[model samples]
Target: MVRYAFSKIGMTSTFTTNGSAQGVTVLKMQPARVLRHETLENGKVVVVVEYDTGHKNKLVRGWVVDNPAEYQVGSPLKAPSLNAGQKLKITGFSKGRGFQDAMTRHGFGGGPASHGSRFHRSPGSVGMRAEPGRVMKGKKMPGQDGNVQVTLRNVQVAYWSTEESVMAIVGGVPGARGGIVFV
Candidate 1:
């Protein structure tokens, strides 16, 4: 088994034992906070950890239970465990650098909003003359943003007695609601 210690990045808590999970006991989590949890856009029970302090700005770290129980905000949970097939590390996603213009980012032309203002939303100049030479490698134009690798760990697991579900995760799980949560 690939043993992993339970831990929260910014939280002031530590756990020596790693959470374990197995079987179909993984299916009950709501999406919450993510850097790039888009890949898991299915109905996957994923637990996300918010890297940002604003309680909204965040990233997708990982999931909650093997068979996750229905989870909601302010729900109590216990620390979970992952064993063999249960432990899934989230991978693959473009990195986000933050903020991009529409024209260059999405590859579009400018439009005129006002009669006097001609340049409404254009990609503008990609490069200068030969002064800088060859449009400069990786010139700041615009394209793609918000997609990063985020991992959740040592999440406190809570019990859902009403549903007979044992895995309840504390804090926010990455991604939007119904997003897939990798082990």
Candidate 2:
């Protein structure tokens, strides 16, 4: 079973344990409000929740639950209990690097870097000679990079604090700091 929560990406720091350092990503969880409940045909209960209720823009999400009696409408939703060394899946949008070149975007090797070489960073020879004259579709050219939804699976939980409503996971996560992530 999986539980869902909306959290903001916090500062990334290194944690020391057993004389070794490991990078960890911190998340600040917001208290969610139970909006409604629905019973599916499969005999599972789905709870609709709203996060950041005090803000102008609120986020509403629905998660399946095993028991419907545990949740009450118009009440604060309980935070998911997480333990250290537990695996979690986190989904969020990656950081956006705008309008990058082919070399930076697609890892293309350009021509020689000598002063005389004209092709430094351009994506050379994009079309055919005669047959099917135009460049093929889905060409690796310059375009937008990142800012897309990314899911990281099996991310181990480093620590969790119920009083502070913060969680730290081992390794890096997608999206810029302060961005919202679903766990």
Candidate 3:
């Protein structure tokens, strides 16, 4: 089975998942935001992007979205280095929220605690004042967590199942399940 992308547009690339039972290839040209780039001591490059899949279907587990080999905001990136069955794993630490005295998001005080400590849910002091004068900018506060952009480059692709139109990447990728991960 073979998958064919019938049309081409300079703006966004959208291929259908028809006939071949393959997943569609959709390359969205979005505004390039602040991307994180880290260089390992060994001279490896890591790029991360907070990608978003516009689809409402949240049940799908895995999909590969590749970044162009050379990408500039308005410019389209070349197709990912690998195709179909191959995997690209991007790993990075999602920002962590600070210690939570309350169990709201973490399900802390929802149920009765075995311990009698009534002060079950609370957020420890954000940070000391005056001494630091400011609560450090990157300080972890109980707020929006995860959804960080992490790019793992040159990851090995297990296989590219053309019939399936999917790539299997090894190792764990960042973001929550069903997160839109760009290769």
Candidate 4:
């Protein structure tokens, strides 16, 4: 490995876990009051919230509520009512697939993959001809896929641990591991 004089490189420690699964984003309400906020790196506005009578401070990220003005210091945050064995809606960004085609993105059945029929995995005839003079607004074409806010309805809650501040749903959930999922 070659070392650069201008850049200081350090080692990052990672531990392998055998029991680790795709854990949901677990937020703990540790009595942290929202103080001030500043828009920092990666387009993330870090909220400088403090806890323990302003003795300790922490930054809150990946919160469902985006408006910083809604949070103020010296005011208690109203957490939503949560309980196990109840059906809840989970809204989160799905796994980002970047740019994709109709066959994978929109599930359009393409032409056969044999000889002269060269239209395999192609979105056939998106053009509306001269009738409307333009394609419809909600045409399912190749573009960005996933990473959009999708709501999973009727997801039954399997477990809810207030001590761990984590909730496990019955089935699959949206977004990648450790991605922000709002209940």
Candidate 5:
């Protein structure tokens, strides 16, 4: 069974393990209070949890679990017990880069560079003539980039401190530091 918890991304640092230095991302688990519980038709249980974001606002998340009796409404959810080298999947939003160009966003190779071709960083030949008059849907155009949920799988735990509720996972974690992440 998978246990879910809400954590904030901490700093990125290196840790010595097995005589080798490995990059790790630190995460500080937030205290989540159980709001309610619901059971699905498929016998799956979902617990709604509320987390204090430290910004005067609350963040609510629903976690699916194998058993609902383990959680009680209006009480703090138990932190997941994790061990070193345990594989974990972390999900969070990536860093947002607002309003990017086609060359920067979609990695489009424009025409000419030196002799004033006027197509240095523009999206070229977007549509065809009368037959299909307009630009087709789902075209790779420049727009919002990042700020979307990203999940990283198979991230091994580099360190875990149950007392402090801090976890360090091997390798990089998506989103900005101090951002909310689910494990």
Candidate 6:
């Protein structure tokens, strides 16, 4: 299994996209404020900042920084350097679906409905017959679904409107509308 940790944090500025006449999309990113930061002994840095995503909660996030000392609290950040047609990665949380069954969650084929066999939509025999005496770990049982963080890589940057603080990307992005994504 891949072990993971939230080693750093940083927030992206609020941005909205607009498709241009030249078949390019533009992203308008707003200035963000630095909240707090940490400098690690290994030269890694993390910064927390506030973004303008208009979410119900304060749009605060953290990310690693090249130089943590360059930013102070309450300071507006400058626009990042991104060019048109640049390929970038967007990382964010996927939408959450609270609970699901085997058919929907694990993609199990249900028994035929016409035969009236009662086996439809069940997970079927999930446990072992007492040799190991316990259900195997990592079994494909239905439980909580989605809300996992994922990265969509190689997404092309259509264009950026630094003046307006928004940039448009060329493909589908993760998360709901107005959700923040890391590039």
Best by lDDT: 2
Answer with 2 or 5, whichever has the higher TM-score. 5
Judge candidate 6 at residue 82 and give its lDDT.
Answer: 71
lDDT against the true structure, per candidate, is 0.42, 0.83, 0.39, 0.56, 0.81, 0.64
Q: Which is superior by TM-score, 1 or 6?
A: 6
In model 5, the clashing pairs are none
Indicate the residue-level lDDT of 28 in model 1: 47
lDDT digits (tens) for residues 35-62 of candidate 3: 4444557665444333323444321122
The candidate, 1 or 2, that scores higher on lDDT is: 2
Rank order (by lDDT, best first) = 2, 5, 6, 4, 1, 3
Local accuracy of candidate 4 as per-residue lDDT tens digits, 22-46: 3332333334455566676666565
Tens-digit lDDT track of model 6 for 102-155: 788878887878776888788888887769878899988889888889897897
**Stretch of 10 with least lDDT, candidate 3:** 1-10
The residue-by-residue lDDT of candidate 5 on 42-77, one tens digit each, is 888888888876768888878788777878899886
- How much is 32 displaced in model 4, in angstroms? 5.2
RMSD each, Å: 15.4, 2.6, 12.9, 12.8, 2.0, 7.3
Tens digits of per-residue lDDT for model 2, 1-183:
334555556656665677678888888887777899888898788888888834689888888977767888988867788899999889989999999999999999899999898999999989997899899999999999989999999999988888888899899888877788888
Cα-lDDT of candidate 2? 0.83
List the lowest-lDDT window of 10 residues for candidate 4.
Answer: 1-10
Off by over 4 Å in 6: 1-30
Clashes (N, CA, C under 3 Å) per candidate = 40, 0, 18, 0, 0, 14
TM-score of 3: 0.36
Model 1 poorest ten-residue lDDT run: 1-10
Which scores higher on lDDT, 3 or 5?
5
lDDT of 3: 0.39
lDDT of 4 at 177: 52
